[model samples]
Target chain A: MMKVLTANRLTDGIAVWLGANGRWLERIDHALIARHREAVDALEQAGQSAFHDNLIVDVAVIDVDEVDGEIYPIRLRERIRAKGPTFRTDLGKQAEFQQASAA
Target chain B: MYRYDEFDHDFVGQRVAQYRDQVERRLSGEITEDAFKPLRLMNGVYLQLHAYMLRVAIPYGTLNSTQMRRLARIARDYDKGYGHFTTRQNIQFNWPKLSDTPAILEELAEVEMHAIQTSGNCIRNVSADHFSGAAADEVADPRPYAEILRQWSSNHPEYSFLPRKFKIAVTGAERDRAAIQVHDIGLHLKRNEAGELGFAVYVGGGQGRTPMIARKIRDFLPEADLLSYTTAIMRVYNLNGRRDNKYKARIKILVHETGEAEFARQVEAEWDKLKASELKLPDADLRAIAAYFAPPELQDRAEGWAGLAARKKDDEGFASWVRQNVTPHKHPDYGVVTISLKPIGGVPGDATDVQMEAIADLAERYSHDEIRVSHEQNLVLPHVALADLEKVYHALLEQDLATANAGLITDIIACPGLDYCALANARSIPVAQEISNRFASAQRQQEIGALKIKISGCINACGHHHVGHIGLLGVEKKGAELYQITLGGSGDENTSIGQIVGRGFEPEKVTDAVETIVDTYLGLRESAEETFIDAYRRVGPEPFKEALYGKTSRAA
Candidate 1:
């Protein structure tokens, strides 16, 4: 299973959820809601909602799950997204495994 | 001390402009790494493992106080706070960014220095004896001719993209301080029967995996045809040298395959066509270059041994420094002092920013504002008065540059090995440090006498291990660092290729092996005057082999 979390930009913060076997499946949304201007004004006049103005320009979604934490590929991707790629750590285990299989 | 002429200055300026454009293109994403690789390399910018490295040529190891100060400024501003002087008489900045290289080159051009031909398959920086003009045993100074070659080869349109990088060295001295025999073309200056200066030229000498002594191509090449003849030889190699295998691309392989006589004949045939052409150097051009290297004015001073003895008696440290660092000069009242870069456990050839400034200051104060970087990875004050030796020694000591181990055992030549170099197989400095620590005692080193131990991390032989009296080659064996030892090599007048004694030794066993070889020499030597090379030549490697492997013979 795999899931994606979105933020403002690539350099902005990111969070992901992983399922068992070190994978993600469920997506969670935490975004601003947009409403018609008249409806918002009416709500403000009637005092039905606390929000009176402002329309949503952006939204973000996150995925969360438990993971087995043993699969290297899933762990590596999570690690890279969390931090950054290792500059001098040679190649990943997946590449080494592929090479071994090819050999 | 060859200053740039109008033509040289213009050529360097054009090169700097070209490099600036290339750097701009690289930064603007117009050129990819693959496309810009050769372009940047042509300008002596290398994308090394961690960062970009720029190799600046110090032609024939000669520099004035102004140039030294400029190098110090470059180190302080552009690079990391230090510069590593390489074994090829070049200085490498290990931490220069890609974008700052052009500005660095522009600054270098201000001081009449550039990094052209320091890399790539062009004629690299021409090297010569460090004590070129001042040595008493010299036939003539080789720098003027070196300068002539430098002019002829700098970005020569036809031969720029040769089979591989080419190197040339010239020496006029009796002792081969320039390691001429290991260069692509080694020119030994000699005078003919008519007292005309000429060159005894050797071709195809190099020190990689297939280490070979250069063979004599011409006994006496007249000074007039120097450039034209050199061009002919290079052209012949450019056309005939190997291109298929990078390992076999050097002219040494070409000489090996074609036979020396045939190669010499081919060069002669090529020269016959081009000898009287525009490529030949004019006498006026030669004289112009020679004028720049004219000796500085000397003052007649007391020549007696009084000054030296007085210094020796007054300061023991100064006495030790003089005993090791001071070398006889052509002038009676002066001497050459080698500031050893190989201080006990320090990185060889590394001078910190402060150290560079201090050396520059010392040169200006005491050395007639002249300094030289020897190919052996040490700084030289070419003209130090005998009376001021103590003063200079104390000043050097303040900077931790005063190590009295000029030609001693601990004064080892080591490349920036695995710690820094991307090409290295194993670390060279630790091994060198181990050796230094094992033989740190001054008394022991003095007893050992003049011994040169050169170590190279890989087969490229940048550290010139093949020419050392004791050569150590670092190799990786089963994921462990191993060292191979060779005995009996000499880079001097009677050049000889060292012979490998036996199989490789583990790192832990190498120091003991070296000690055993030294002990074997001490036991077999005829007298204390017989150096390590002489003893090795006299007795051969059998005794040393016996001492190391202990009667167990390994199949070759």
Candidate 2:
């Protein structure tokens, strides 16, 4: 299993995942992946460091799987966090880019 | 309806200013999340799954037109154009920014509302009967006492950091509309043999991972002793409540461990010391507070009796709505109207800003300027003349707020589970939507009659599943959503924790399981008048279990 570091940004509490570019991204597809044990440890350390830096809150290292070069969180909770609330798809990060930005 | 005095205004303003400063510091990285979490929580700000959620308290579930309008404006401006009405009768904005919360609090304070003490290990909002002054079954209005408790408990230094959060609910009717039996402290206002008003006090009832009914500690506590007795219970619990593990911290756990009778004795011994102190309320003060809740002078709209019947005959929709969503008022010409937020295949308690503004307008014009948020996740016009109901129904239909199921099967109570909540193991809103859609037919629902299906994403039971007639508790089993069903629970006067029936059902199969339970209940029922609860109570869970699972339904 692979892992990815995730947290909600401190200002607006929007869910974000640590990306390979060393910046938090809203879409989980671009998140930094850790396929080995040592890489997973590095991701956990990065989550703690980001949390301590006050850039994010509720930091976690969640399990993920890559299929056909697409990343998907193993748990439904994380999946919802990555996309949007299953009940109101029109309101969360999964909404249209312009509409979500407007919100 | 209580106006903010100079002191109230000043207190709320200062708190808002304090929160503004705290938010600024956190944004600038001068304060850490660990240090700033409790401060924000005290102001009702929470960091949820996708965004920061702001829970605004509606004291005793009462709000005037102006205050409600302000909430609508807040929903439009700060949130994503909608808000969730919680089972505790509070409204939550699911997408508030941490930085904008101070301004939201400022707007709320301008209307004599605030998010103060909505969270934290303190006395949360004091809830009262939604039909306190209007219900036909009358004893006395309970909101004044609830207001008094609100005043006494706000920012109290001694009780601010209790072992766990505390809740107090007050209801005046003997029918128990407030679900007082399921609160940390349940106060039932009643009349003694001499016709003097007092309360029947029940303590330690709560629902969570552990569900327990409160014990009747005192049958009739005099009206003036409200503060004294409450303080005594608080002091006893504060001193002895378990601080070892957070899960076992509620006073219900204490009452269970030390027998309910002994817990009452401890509270009594503590009360003996504080009964004569300043805690004893004065008659003048009580009267002064009660004056604020004086009912509006209702005019004689007696012609509504004939006009309403004719109107109902003209429109079957209005007649069915009248049968389900209207409750008789104390005044013969008036009726309490429930503006159902449960539109078929729609979210349970999420009202759009436009809908909220429309309700505010309706309350201002026709409902004595009063609005109530019920624990069942519906907006209520506490007093509407029967003659105006036809007009009100038409207006509600425009806003998609005219669902005729108030207590029926489609009228489900659901929490913001994994959808927005951080603690939920499964999704509650979708489950509620599925179940509601399955039972969407109004005719079928009316036939089922007064069935409460409460859903919770986790064992915390914020959705009050432990007390629902048909309770569904969602858990994560092997990383998938599983719902366990419970039978025969209720939150009314004779409150009982529902007993868990057979094994769990997967998400795809949960709705079918619920339909099976409802079908089983309908078959065993003696008559149409026998409610699902009555039929279940008459013949225990064996029949329901056998229907759910053949012979293998021994126990979970």
Candidate 3:
């Protein structure tokens, strides 16, 4: 229900699914996306490319809805994305996991 | 005069380094514009409409000859051979490049200065009475306490990330030269019944869109608890202050919403936890800070009244300058000289390189190498000997810095409105110029008597228009510039927000409106002693309203 789509002509582009009813919003070169290399890369891989001397990015996404045009799974996914990951995912946590694996 | 200790030095060095890293990252494409926005803002670098502006703090409006010289150097090397001294006792380099800020910070740090906490949502460079040490009416020097607050709030982890930018002002004198009531936190230094130092703390005063005079939170807070108590207030504001709307994010709004009594109770609860902390400043530390600001050695000399009288009798120009620019100093043989940056029709606060050097020379030679940037956007030599007044006045006249309109109607405070500010809705400088030209007569100004006319291009109130006796606010209506007039605002000990007189006026009609208001005041005034504000208060705005709108109009 939730789709992360990237534009072919933009870099650091993100297409967020807002609600159902095929309402897809794209934010390009946003501060948060610009800060996260992985997020930017994911968008780039999904077809977003550098534009306007690499300063701007263009991206798009698609969303399907139920009979009433109400977004359900897409809404949930967008909410999750907006809030970010709940658990710790930094290098310190990774190192702890690595130590446990070695033990 | 608070010298940067090892800790202070290290912190500034680290701050510069951190900002350098952020700059490097932004330049190298490691971080995008979005990520670097906050980072740049935190370093006092703003991408203004035309160019990047670097606001360097002049803490408590106090500066030594060396610091001022360094500022001159910065103006010469980095910026266009001039700088704009702001209402907040800070200087802004109007044309700094984004890439050159780190080097600028490095240079500033060399002079025991940094742009830290200047632009960020933090305890900004705490402003104080310009005549802190030299004012005739001052009970005690306020700079020592200001310096203490500066240190306490510098990189103070918890309060640094508040909902909005915060400003604090201190004054030891009875006359509120610092405009304390319009600041986020206003500290009035007072001696208690037991002869111990204490603060009459006021909270939630600010001047942006909603200009409110700070309400007194604590009638008497012990001097030792200044830091801990302030920390508690800031913590409470940071936690409970609204972040949803940027306009309502100021502590004033929070205080308004929660009610002062409840807010004070909450602050008290927070202070209970912080009272037992290491934030309580030691007597030795206070003494050490106070030692740096100890009064300069005074020479026993005659009051030079005869020399001043002789000059006044001989030269009309010298007499005019003395009448307007000279203020009473605490020392019998000394007087405070305000070297006007507002030269006739020039920008209100802009000083060229030559002017800066000239003032610096005057400060070192005549005054005691102490220069103060007043909240009214003028420079002051706090301790000019009475004998040297004529010489200093002549020198100032030569440099075109001597306007001799310190508190007159010509001494207008206007923000860099639509011309430079990206947020301005209308032009402030031109309107200020129009008003200044209208009141160009010395006789009329003397009659007006110490009136403040502040103008802001927008509701942001960067010009402190809310506290002006005549407040001009520029608003956009139907895509045209319209000016609103407010009367009877006072920024002194008895602070009050000005009330809007009537409907907005066209840009061209604003001067006429101001004249009408002044005319009304003059006609209604009981005597020469009763100022525009006094007459307005006594007679009410009805006369002024009648003068502006006429009797036939029914619209209030």
The most accurate candidate by lDDT is 2
**After superposition, which runs of candidate 3 have C-alpha atoms over 4 Å from their true positions?**
A1-103
In order, what DockQ does each candidate have?
A: 0.03, 0.83, 0.02
Task: Quote model 2's TM-score.
Answer: 0.98
Candidate 3 residues A1-103, lDDT tens each? 2234423211112223222222333321111221245644554443333322333332344332332432222332222222221121221112223321100
lDDT of 2 by residue, B1-556 (tens): 6888999999999999999999999999898888999999999999999999999999999998898899999999998999999999999999999989999999999999999999989999999889889999978899999999999999999999899999999999989988888899999999999998899999989999989999989999999999999999999999999999999999999999999889999999999999999999999999999999999999999988999999999999999999899999999999999989899988889999999999999999999999999999899998899989999999999999988999999999999999989999998999999999999998999889999999999999998999999999999999999999998899999899999987899999999999999999989999999999999899999988888898675744
Query: Residue B526 CA error for candidate 3 (Å)?
Result: 1.1
Strongest candidate by DockQ: 2
Q: Model 3 misses residue A59 by how many Å?
A: 18
Candidate ordering by TM-score (highest first): 2, 3, 1
TM-score of 3: 0.84
Cα misplacement distance, residue B33 of candidate 2 (Å)? 1.3
lDDT of 2 by residue, A1-103 (tens): 6999999999999999999998998878788999999999999998889888999999999998876677878888998888788877777777844323211
Q: What TM-score would every model get versus the actual structure?
A: 0.84, 0.98, 0.84
**Candidates sorted by lDDT, descending order?**
2, 3, 1
Angstrom error of the Cα, residue B531, model 2: value is 0.7
Which should have the higher TM-score, number 2 or number 3?
2
Q: Can you write out model 3's per-residue Cα lDDT over B99-151, one digit (the tens) per residue? A: 78899999989888888888878889999999888989988888999999888
- Over 4 Å off in model 1, which ranges? A1-103, B303-305, B554-556
Clashing residue pairs in candidate 3, if any? A7-A47, A7-A48, A10-A49, A10-A58, A11-A49, A20-A71
Order the candidates by DockQ, highest first. 2, 1, 3
